[model samples]
Target: MRADPTRASSADASETDPSGDDRAHDAAVPIARSLEAILMVADEPQSLVSLATAVGAPTAAVRQAIESLVADFDGADGGTRRGFELREVGGGWRFYVREEFDPVVRDFVLTQNPTKLSQAALETLAVIAYKQPITRSSIAQIRAVNVDSVVRTLLGRGLVTESSTDSETGAITYETTELLLTHLGINSLDELPLISPLLSDGRGGFDDVA
Candidate 1:
């Protein structure tokens, strides 16, 4: 009997291989494109499992494609200025603005608020923004003043939040809120306006003048 090539091919195609190499390849095409779409549409970083399920591909394969896409972006020249980067934050993967180009990027996107922050409010906010999830006592110690009023003002302005309470000490830990990022016109706290002098100010006394 002569061997039938077409029948063999059909049989091979129909067979369910435990190994998903072939499926991974076929899935990768749409998956790769879908990953881009998801990242573009997402408000924040998404997880590997989320991307895989969203693109209907295996998590491993989607991760591989994501790495490839990131490599391609890094290799491209315009990409650096565009300031697009892929990063993992809060235990999930997401797209982020590259740190090197934030100034120019913010100029185009963020509008300045005419409202000015008082020295005390600015001081408290700075502490919360930098050493976030920090206790009120810690902030008070740094500011060298009672921060109850400052904390209340920040909370009222929607820029900071009492993130947690210490189980043992019962102290309230404050941190910058999502509203803070939005108000600052940035995507994350990591992109907060960098004041080199403020960062270097060991005494924690710095001006927030525009």
Candidate 2:
């Protein structure tokens, strides 16, 4: 009477594969849905690696998912083309208001009462507008208050958006959007009033106002 070595080996292998069941469960998630969930809240374009990591999918699968999303949004799948488009910019993927729909979206955002921003959002937007590439921590420091929610509000309103991420600090730097300028009836940041004169002491400028 002898024990089966093959059965014992199979048991050992199964014991070592801690993630085998988890991986199978994760595979049940549709790649497109996973990508959509992550991209919806993503403030900036996500690289393939980042998207893959966030979705727990392989890079090739993520790339395919992005392509599928592009086609789906473009009406290639027999659906109406979306008002927004998924674009690859600066080596990453993000959603943008389609060029033809920008005016409509802008009008809706600026004129729609439901979209009105709060005082905190306005203040955070102003800081981003003047600073032109300030991080959340820096904005919080200038305002002397937590700006996380306010910044999210500005982003939701399309007044401010992430411009870049700090390589060393991994902080997201934000800036005013063209939609903000359109709402303000201005062509450029230069058209905004100078903060230096607005300060009573004119010593610390924006920091003093905040």
Candidate 3:
């Protein structure tokens, strides 16, 4: 009996497309939940292209998802408004604490987390350590959260110091102190892992840099 070409092609297609069924399943959940997860830990605003690349979605879909998220966070759909929000700055999207909640959040960080470094302080310190001589505003831009209180904490702890102030902008730049190196148990910033590799994009096009 001769082999049937039609049946042979069908079997080959199935073998090559074994996971075609899973594509829909994987894509179904990534737009909202995955974006939220990414934004939660993000250190800076992410552009639409970057976000789409991370979530494996088209830019259009990502835009729609962003709009939906904005509305959701704003309580437009009759849900409890979130204390934080997704905001666009420097041509990217990032999360920020609502203005009204800043005082309370700062108080909690200073009072409740007195013994240990709050996450905000740690993040700000890392920024200064890697991007030394960075302004407070620059640090805030990278973190997409206000760094004023966190900078004060690092200053009080002696982990970071004001290195210089911009002559043109008058923005004070910060640098890591010896105390921070001692705590880190490293000789220099070079010992710190490459910042690009740790970032989500691996290259973190940080030209705007706050």
Q: What are the candidates' C-alpha RMSDs?
A: 12.8, 7.4, 15.1
Instruction: Tell me the tens digit of each residue's lDDT in model 3 across 33-134.
Output: 788889887755688899999999899778877877888899995887999999886577888889898678767755755698877788788888877888
TM-score to native of every candidate shown: 0.44, 0.60, 0.48
What would the C-alpha RMSD of candidate 1 be, to one decimal place?
12.8
The better-scoring model by lDDT among 1 and 2 is 2
lDDT (tens digit, per residue) of candidate 1 on 17-85: 535766665667677777988887664357788788888878788888887677766766455434587
How far out, in Å, is residue 150 in model 2?
Answer: 3.7
Error of 3 at 57 (Å): 0.7
Best by TM-score: 2
Report the error of model 1 at residue 3, Å: 9.0
Tens-digit lDDT string for candidate 2 (1-210): 798999999899888765865664455348877888788877656888999998787898788778878888899957999888898875788887798986677567656647567788887787788876888888888788998878867765777877887776655689988888899999998889877777676644275432
Model 1 worst lDDT window (10 residues): 201-210
Q: CA lDDT, every prediction?
A: 0.71, 0.78, 0.77
Q: In model 1, which runs have C-alpha deviations exceeding 4 angstroms?
A: 1-26, 76-82, 111-210
Cα displacement (angstroms), candidate 1, residue 11, comes to 16
